[model samples]
Target: MNAAPPLTPAQISFFHEEGYLIVPDVFAPADLEPLRQELHREIDRKARALKAEGRLENLHEELDFDRRLAAIYRDSKENGETIMRHLEGLRGGGFHAPEMFDVIASPKLLAKVGSLLGTGEIVASSVYRIRPKLPNIGRGVVPWHQDSGYFSTHCDKQLIITCWAPLVDATVENGCMQILPRTHRGEVAMHHTGGNAGFLVIKDENLPDDPRKAVTAACPRGGVVFMTNRTPHCSTPNYSDHIRWSMDLRYQSAEAPNNVGLWPESLDAAGKADDAFYEKGNVACYPPEADFLVQSRLHPEQVTNYAEYVRRRETYDRTQANFSAFRRWPESVATK
Candidate 1:
């Protein structure tokens, strides 16, 4: 396969100015077929296990990837959630398959990221999420919130890019993202916990700009929607017939504060990491997940391999250790 090209100067400028960029052809539509198939197999595998255990009645094997989960969800919300938790992990490292990692570390995507970041050293975080927004289900409908709302306050000014790529042609009908352009240059707005599906949410009054000014981020399969940590964005409800499958991968410059090589010497299966490990991890922008050096032109030897990537994510997740004690925010957003 030919190497993916880097973003042009104009594209880079636009990203800096608008706070987000939607670039098409980041990958061929077929390039993501493996991942789609793998996820479908995982769903099938879990559903079959549930059926065998008499926990679930319908396996929904006749349906394809997009509709099968919806059928299971319609039958039992518990079963639907179980499958999601298994695929997305308890945190975010649950599914660290090679296919998922291949998308995360794709050279074509990184070339554009490197250009936007103006650096050769890049750090990939384990906070990457695999989202399968079920039709008419509010589980995947995100509210307006900047990515930084979930990070530590100390990382308010730092730059951690979010690369969101859909497995299908993301259209307005299927809950495409809505981004508040030029609003990212300011501070992270007030975010309330307990948004839809446990996501952090920034209320309309707290948003930097009027929510009416937000632009629809309709993108196609193989395209990528790049946004900064401070970019205010949200996804609408999926009103279409199929699932809106997508992944939001996070990356940062190596210069940013991260836990790339700061593993605890005594992190055990029981999650007893030494005090120093927790102390060191708190300084990271997002401390719970492991961060690894994905690309390092100056220190190529330090780049993490697939095995090591799996190791780091699994190791950190196994610990289940608490890291940063971010500032407390006001609780209780009115929900209907």
Candidate 2:
């Protein structure tokens, strides 16, 4: 095991002041060998082919995040014989492989995230995304948006810190993420649906006239760009010859509110709780893999009344998707 590097005072001060920071050389490039091979094998076979064919489709439309959002399967044979197999173990009942958990639990990665977040007990596991950026593909751009833009707005605050980790080297040439520095101080910018990837983009009334004059954070693989949920950012296309594969992970304190509604359905199946409970709080819960801690920061009385929060969130999530409130981009802008 490598010795965990001390978080520099400068880095701490910068994150405190700027709402985001890029930590470079945090993980040894060579250390990612196993994941790199597995990721490339998966992307090269399935994701790469999809991009090549200009097909941006996701099978799991029923999922809140699945609309217009594309994903790669580690074990899908749909694109012909794939080399990878989904591990029997899963987190949150999602399709994550056990090896994916190994990467998240890596001592080096955990130590860095824990240090920044000020929590030792963290659930960095939930969603695993492989955004495939294929060579000469015009569809690679992720439109300018904030993460909380698409999520449930029922919580009192954003309780998430997202970590974007690239399996291959990410660069400006490959359309890595671009950020508007220090803008997280503003209100969570109002977002409706954007044409691309169901992204959360701010309306012209909510955006600065000259947002392009903002700074962009483009770093190498193994380094990470950490941001609050409200931070504004976007990525460009993969015009370069190489493919860009990356994963976006959300880490939350056990005490924060979540999307999963109250309790587990399996527990519901056992008749411990009723359907009403499921509709309210269980939806807020991360998939089973996150292993979220139920001890919340809310008053004990409020925590006990999770049904209220769950119901409110469900309504809020729907209201957010109402298209009439949004300024729709041209169909071309949405697709490309």
Candidate 3:
């Protein structure tokens, strides 16, 4: 594999000080084509299955990739909830598909990540998300929250990076990510479950004193934005007529202790045992899914393959019968 260009001294310093960085054109069109094809294939399969169940009247085959899902939802009297559900099936640690595995395991991408992490041993977190931001969909608009807010306190001190890359041009009108600069230097702000999607969001009172400092991270296809786990970021509603396709993948030091393959054990704010939160065989983390080793210098041969990735995911899916009952916060939390 060709060596990825290393980040400049200034770039590394900026990331440390500002909490996020945007690297443009990290992957070429040819590199992204496979993932794109896989996404479209998944969409087509879902559409067909929905049609077979008489949930959709038409497949919207005439629409282009950017507008097909939107068109399907717009035409369906059910207002696309079914379509959203199908897409949600592809979110969070949702890399069971071969195309997804290829994308995350891209050597070029991992090299860029390795530069920031200062290590070649990288553990790809199973907590990645594939976001297809459709126009005006509640779930498509992610609320402002730190990624660490959803994680167990056990991994608090570890450095886990989030790399968000768009498959299409992410513009202001298409709901590109907006981030508060330098927020990672601070503590994880208090968050509550609220917003149209009912996702976790930092309260307005906790927002940085200067809202003007927040900037929209718009970039072309294949450009990637890297952020620390504690950075405050969120995407706005997609006002455009098309779907804003993007993927958010995460990486952590392979040496960090995480609940990747093991069942999630609840921990208190101090990272100690919490009996109430512990379940006998529950998975860990929000949207608990299996993690895998993407890049490893110590044990390169042990890195997970496409088949192993699928097996771990399938095993979790089957064993996580009560996964939905898990909650990060109490029921008293207001979501409006």
User: Judged by TM-score, which candidate is best?
Assistant: 1
lDDT of 2: 0.53
lDDT tens readout by residue for model 3, 125-171:
76776778888776688877888877765555568899999999999
Cα RMSD (Å) between model 3 and the true structure? Answer: 4.8
- Work out the TM-score per prediction: 0.94, 0.66, 0.87
Q: What is the Cα-based TM-score of model 1?
A: 0.94
Write model 2 residue lDDT over 1-336, tens digit each, in one string. 656764677886687577678887767877666766654344344445565676524433342221112223322334311212221112113223434545655667666666666766554434445555554445456776776664445432645677887766788787788877777766667555654544555654565334775556777778877877777777877666566767676776654544333333334333233566545554342322223332233433333223432333233333322212123333234322
Q: Each prediction's Cα lDDT score?
A: 0.86, 0.53, 0.75
Which of the two candidates, 2 or 3, achieves a greater lDDT against the reference? 3
Best model number under lDDT: 1
Error of 2 at 285 (Å): 6.9
Scored by Cα lDDT, where does model 3 land? 0.75
Which runs of model 2 end up more than 4 angstroms from their true locations?
A: 1-3, 43-95, 259-263, 266-336
Query: Per-residue lDDT for 233 in model 1?
Result: 98
The TM-score of candidate 3 is: 0.87
For model 1, residues 162-277, the per-residue Cα lDDT tens digits are 99999988999999999999998997898888788888888888999999999999999999999999999999999999999999999999988787866744555544456776
